[model samples]
Target: MTVKQLSSSGQFNILCMPEPEREIDGVYIGDLLSWVMGKAEADNVWITIMSNINVIAVASLSDVSCVLLAEDVTLESDVLNTAKEKGINILSTPLSAYEAALKVSGMI
Candidate 1:
């Protein structure tokens, strides 16, 4: 299913949708930028506890479709703005990464 649908209709919260036009395989954990770059696929919904601007950068570099902040965290305006400029999707939810992963995994 689409990331937007998963967040809006599924069981998770999605914050931003810069590139909502894209579809991902499973909900990929958006943590350890380098690790994700090497491990995540192009269609994975990134679920990370990080809210740094670097997260957006890595998302772009990794060719990811969207990012989900899996926690009640606040992303800096600059980070969100960068994501918009980069055309990367961003989201946030009260659930932790692990929890979000579980919910997303069940979907696919």
Candidate 2:
């Protein structure tokens, strides 16, 4: 599933849609930035509760299709802007990280 389709399916709230058409090959759920950096595969949707600027960096470095912020986590203006500038798609959801991961798994 693409990021745009995922957002339109009513499962997630898109906070920053810089690359909505990006394809999601799989899902990776983790909060530890270092672990995610080493393990997250390209084209996978990374699901986490982290809403920091470093999330953008990790997503970029890991080459994930997008970043899904679980638990309704909100990003700061600067972080959001930087994500947009960097062409990183970010989706938010009220569900916990586990719930979001399950939903993404079903979609993919």
Candidate 3:
């Protein structure tokens, strides 16, 4: 599924969607930035509760299609703006990481 399609489905809230047409090829769930940076594949829908500025950096470095902020986790204005400026797609959901993964699994 594409980032725009996923956000339009109402499963997640769009925080920063500079690349809304980006396609989601897979899902990666984790909180540790280092681990995620290594494990998250390009075009994967990364699911995590981390809302820090580094999350944006890791997302860019990992080349993930989008960052799924689980459990309603939110980013600060500066981080959100950075995500927008960096052309990173960041989404949020009220569901836990596992639950959100399940939902993404069904969708993809």
Candidate 4:
């Protein structure tokens, strides 16, 4: 599924969608930035609770389809802006990372 389709499906709330047409091939759930960077596959939806600026860097490096900020985590204004400038698709959800991952898994 594409980021736009996923967001419009009402499974999660989209926060920043600079690349809504990005394709989602899989899902990755992680909190450690380094771990996620090393393990997350390209074109996967990354689910994490961390909403820092570093998340944008990791997402760009890993080339993930999008970042799902779980458990209602909110990003700082600068971080959100950076995500937009960097063309990162970020979605937010009240669900935990596990739940978000499960939903994404079912989707793709």
Candidate 5:
């Protein structure tokens, strides 16, 4: 499923979607920045409770289609700006990481 389609499913709130049409190939759930950077695949939806500037950098380096912020975690203003500038798509949900992953799994 595409990022846009997933966002429209009402499971998440759109934070910044610079590439909503980007396709989701899979899901990666992690909070460790370095581990996620090394393991997350291109076009995968990275699910995490992390909401920092480094998260943006890792997402860029990992080339994930989007960052799914679980537990309604949100990036700071500066980090959100950086994400927009880098064309990183982001979404947030009230569910925990595992719950969010289940939702995404069912979708894509």
Candidate 6:
């Protein structure tokens, strides 16, 4: 399913907008920045508790579809702004990345 679709479906929340939906139909990876950049694939829905500018940087470098800042974490204003400019989609979620991962896994 597409990112928008997934969000509206109530299965997952869309933390970022204008994001590509790649891994939604497959799997989700909820690792930290370093591991995610090396191991996650493009179009994958990346869920992490981190809510910093670096997360956006990692998402951009890795070409991820979107990022879910889970566990009630939020990004800095500048980070969100930069991500928007970079065409990176980052979403904030009430649930932690671990929770989102589990829900996403069960759906796919």
**Model 6 over residues 1-108: C-alpha lDDT tens digits?**
666665665644554576555445444566567899888887777877777778878988987777776777767778878888887876666776677777666655
lDDT of 3 at 83: 95
In angstroms, the error of model 1 at 76 is 0.4
Scored against the true structure, residue 46 in model 4 reaches a CA lDDT of 94
* lDDT minimum window of 10 residues, candidate 3: 7-16
Model 6 poorest ten-residue lDDT run:
19-28
Cα lDDT, all candidates? 0.77, 0.92, 0.93, 0.92, 0.94, 0.70
Candidate 2 residue runs with Cα over 4 Å from true position: none
Residue runs of model 6 more than 4 Å from their true location after superposition: 11-15, 20-23, 27-31
| Per-residue lDDT of model 3, residues 1-108, tens digit only | 899998998788998899989999899999999999888899999999888899999999899999999999988999999999999999999999999999888898
Q: What TM-score number comes out for model 3? A: 0.97
- Over the stretch 10-99, how does candidate 5's per-residue lDDT look in tens digits? 989999999989999899999999899888899999999988789988999899999999998878999999999999999999999999
Put down candidate 4 lDDT per residue, 4-95, tens digits, no spaces.
99999797998889898999999999999999999999999999999888999999999999999999999999999999999999999999
Instruction: Write candidate 1's Cα lDDT for 23-45 as tens digits.
Output: 77876775688899899887887
Top lDDT: which candidate number? Answer: 5
Give one digit per residue, the lDDT tens place, for model 2 in 1-108. 889999897989988898888999999999999999888899999999888899999999899999999899999999999999999999999999999999988888
Per model, how many backbone clashes are there? Answer: 6, 0, 0, 0, 0, 7
Clashes by residue pair, model 5: none
The per-residue C-alpha lDDT of model 6 at residue 13 equals 51
TM per candidate comes to: 0.87, 0.97, 0.97, 0.97, 0.97, 0.80
Error of 6 at 23 (Å): 6.2
Off by over 4 Å in 5: none
